[model samples]
Target: MASAFIGSSVKTTKGPSVAGTLAETVAAVSRWGNQPSSEDVEEMIRDSALARHAALVKYLENKLAQAKGKLKKVEKALAKVQENLEPTELPTDLETISDEERFLFRKIGLSMKPYLFLGRRGVFDGTIENMHLHWKYRELVKLIVKRKNIAQVKHIAISLEAESGGVLVSVDKTTQGYAIIVYRGKNYMCPQALRPGNLLTRRQALARSVELQRYEALKHHITDLQERIELVTSELEEMEAGKKFEVHKALYSKFDDGSIPNEDEEGEEEPFSEVEDPKSEEGKLEGQSMIPADCNLRYQAL
Candidate 1:
């Protein structure tokens, strides 16, 4: 807001002199047809005074206006300095560069922020929760959990430039129900799976390290798939229990009271109607049937 009283102050102060001169000229005006009188001479003096006063005022206004403009420029510069003196909060898209990180960036002659690599747009879309973590590392952790199908981070650690081409290392956290996944890159080696001790050559070590990392990374997924296979196998077993498993009836000590039913036994046998008589009383099932070839004959449920 520029001041409302800059050149106007000069105009106000010098305005009275101009008005006074004009008033004297008006008072000195002669009555009709009186040009040669003393009134005319007084009028001329008054007009000259008015012109000089007006010029003085014009000069003052120009000088004052120029001074006012300079003052405004000075005021703006001072305000910017004051603003710089006040502390500024960190921007949302940027993390505070630590002294060590600053040193590293200076060494490399590259200025990069950790948040620049975290691309978090549309991650939680259609999710029931509307919240997001505040920091980049936390967001990266969240991304890992979301992609790895896990709920919470079990543990997190960082090593500067831990990966082969990595510049820095970090982790993040997020919301959802997912399993945990750990990725250690090619630097991790397994003593039990691989040969004991380090590799024989640098090339062999690098290749073996990448291979081991791949296997280790896929190990959990393979286990999860195997679990799903077992689930499906159990379901199939349950569904086929009656049609295909009736052959185990003979191993069950079921006699149907030993009174043979009216079904013909001379023709093709009924697989579920002819079990051996029970030795133990309580393990008998309701009907008799042929024993399964794979049945364990020694164990009885009762």
Candidate 2:
């Protein structure tokens, strides 16, 4: 019967848990009467291990492919972000340059033709005529105007030293259109045209004075605001700290009861005895004697 069973097992090798059943199948193939061949068992184990490794390798290859795809997506996303954040360059035409160099020389020459006569004599002057000259002279005139306006607006003035060790007053509101000469504690106003020096007009001096006053006021206001902000900030910090301490104290004392001994109970005097003790008969006798003596003394006084 055992031999018959072995033969049946070997004949029907296909079953669940095929790898585990292979050992039983091999044993049955040997008829349970002899040992199985080592070469066949070794070959079967090698084939099973190779199949598992092949499946693992395929899974890893799929994972590697997914990782590469994800990396490519991330790189593309980074590139898009960088492109969006990049700064734009300004147009070349918007850049500042010398108008004389950019304009046609012929146009400039034609514009200056009318002014050529003015240029021949020193009395004739050159003003901003062409675009090139306008570009250059416009800013220069604007700066000069600004300086003159400042000198006129300011109440105070500045003086320049002349080559002859004399002083030239460039700006003075009281001494208008003239350079003031200070000598021997006296001022002598000279004609501005004849003085061969620059003079600031009244408008320019006043403008500068107003500008300086405004600047000083702004600085003072800023300083005051800063000081007030600091004071308020410090007070707020102190208040917050005090509040925190109060909250902490409340929390710490939450479990404590409010019961306390009264002032009278802490150090109170005993009341007079309402009833005499029976054990102190001597005290009762003395009380009775004192009452009788008091009554006899009251009768005698009456």
Candidate 3:
């Protein structure tokens, strides 16, 4: 069966490009020293750039952690589902009821309200328990099965009788849906534990198997995205650090090489002040190119 939360699952496949955002912030600051600037202004620009980069990195780290948490949860659930799909020893002997007894029980069941409803997850352990509970008070247990054809309903009826130790009385059509009437035989004895080692039929297991495949794909995809994001974030940090070191080296080398006069020689040094920042026309284009077009919509959906 397909996942019920298809819309949400679709969004999870592709999330925000957080690494791209960090790269944009780094690129914006990389152009800082292209023009001559004072030390204080340079320091302020560096601080702003670093702060933004750190924030983006933190956000991506948190996102990665959340994806991992979800993957863990999915894996745990998948394990249980796989266990249910395994083959196990089931009761082979079944109690038989006469035609007269089946007709009488079917009449009784038709007039009574349904005790339980069965959907895609058919013939689980809980259904058997509930059937026993209803049988404790009455001879017949009525079940309504929906969204299934005649063959599937017949399969469910057979599985129910085998698992619950009840006699299959009749499978009838009613206004609500396909109705299954089960008669607890004259020699009925409730088991101490109704929970079976494995209760799902082949069809039910197939449905669950499909759902497991979807989650498996999703887990792997999230892991891939996390790796890519971390790689990009690391590269952005390295570029920022290297750019800052280069700027510092260039400024200090000018003083050491006697290019800028000292205070003793020039009588006084030029007062430190911010310079006129150049227009960064390429920054917008660079950021736009770094982020995927569909990432924003997917992130919002998430």
Candidate 4:
């Protein structure tokens, strides 16, 4: 009976231990099951992806807006360039000049000797009207083109012929300047209005020239800005793809080479020291340093 009882006690203890282990395993399995399901994890991943996609789309939309603005500015600048380049004069039916007619014009034009000067404001309204006034007195007009490039002088000569409705007879290069002899055409009829409506004033011409230069500079600047923007976009794309890109080395290397102004260094003030009154004895002795060494010492002693 004693042996049977001891065996039964051992069995009971072993059974409980086995049961406890199984229960612990069941609780562990339950805890594991309580974790997120694969479908839930996939859904979370999808939501995260959608959020990232939305952010990228927003960034792209902003970039597109900026590009549109820049494009509009570029178009306006180009239109201005075109407008400035076009001749602001009426189109004339120009007939070809014969050699004899040209010779006679040069000879008579040299004799008349009335001159007109063209300055920086090339072929403005004032110049065209002056040419007509000269033509009213004489059949031929002598135009003196000064302070202009050879190409510009040629262009001006052609423009003069067209705008003034005169036949270009001779273009003589002189030490003084280019002598453009133009003949009032064979059927030259004085216009009711001397100055064309489209011709710009001297000031207007100058303003247009300045604007054209500014537009050209702005065009180059815009191109450089676009290039930089493209580089930045490429770098951003690389970063988004978990790739390393050296933006500093590529775009900021020039800035790095230049001396960067340190705010601390620039903001630093010199140490303040109080100055002694010039009327004081010590101040007077210090100020008398140019005097003889003995005199200075004696004054200090005094």
lDDT of 2 by residue, 1-302 (tens): 99998887885546565555777788777775665588776555544443433443344344345435544654554344333221222222221223342232212322221211111011101211221233332211100111234333221111111111111112111211111111110232232233222222334333333444444443553454344445434433554354422333332322122222233442343442333212211111111111111111111100
lDDT of every model, 2 decimals: 0.29, 0.29, 0.60, 0.57
Q: How accurate is candidate 1 locally (lDDT)?
A: 0.29
| Model 4 ranges off by over 4 Å | 1-93, 110-112, 213-302
**Model 4 C-alpha lDDT per residue in residues 132-210, reported as the tens digit of each score:** 8988877888776664466566567767776787776766655446667777877889998888766677777765555
**In candidate 4, how many Å is residue 149 off?**
3.6
- Tell me the spans in candidate 3 whose CA falls farther than 4 Å from its real position: 1-80, 86-93, 200-302
Candidate 1: list runs displaced more than 4 Å: 1-108, 111-201, 217-221, 241-302
**TM-score of predicted structure 4:** 0.44
**Which residue pairs clash within candidate 4?**
none
Q: Give stretches of model 2 more than 4 Å off.
A: 1-181, 184-192, 195-197, 243-302
Candidate 1: residue 33 Cα off by (Å): 99
Q: How well is each residue in 1-302 modelled by candidate 1, as lDDT tens digits?
A: 24766655664454445556866666667434345667676555544543433443344344345435544654554344333122222222322345464343333221111211111111111110111121212222111222242111222111111111122222323222121111222233322322112112333333333433334433543454344445434533443353333223322213222322221431233232322322221121222211222212221110
Q: Choose the strongest candidate by TM-score.
A: 4
Cα lDDT for residue 67, candidate 2: 39
What's the true lDDT of residue 123 in model 3? 68
Q: Comparing candidate 2 with candidate 4, which one achieves the higher TM-score?
A: 4
Worst 10 residues of 3 by lDDT: 293-302
Ten-residue stretch with the least lDDT total in model 4: 293-302
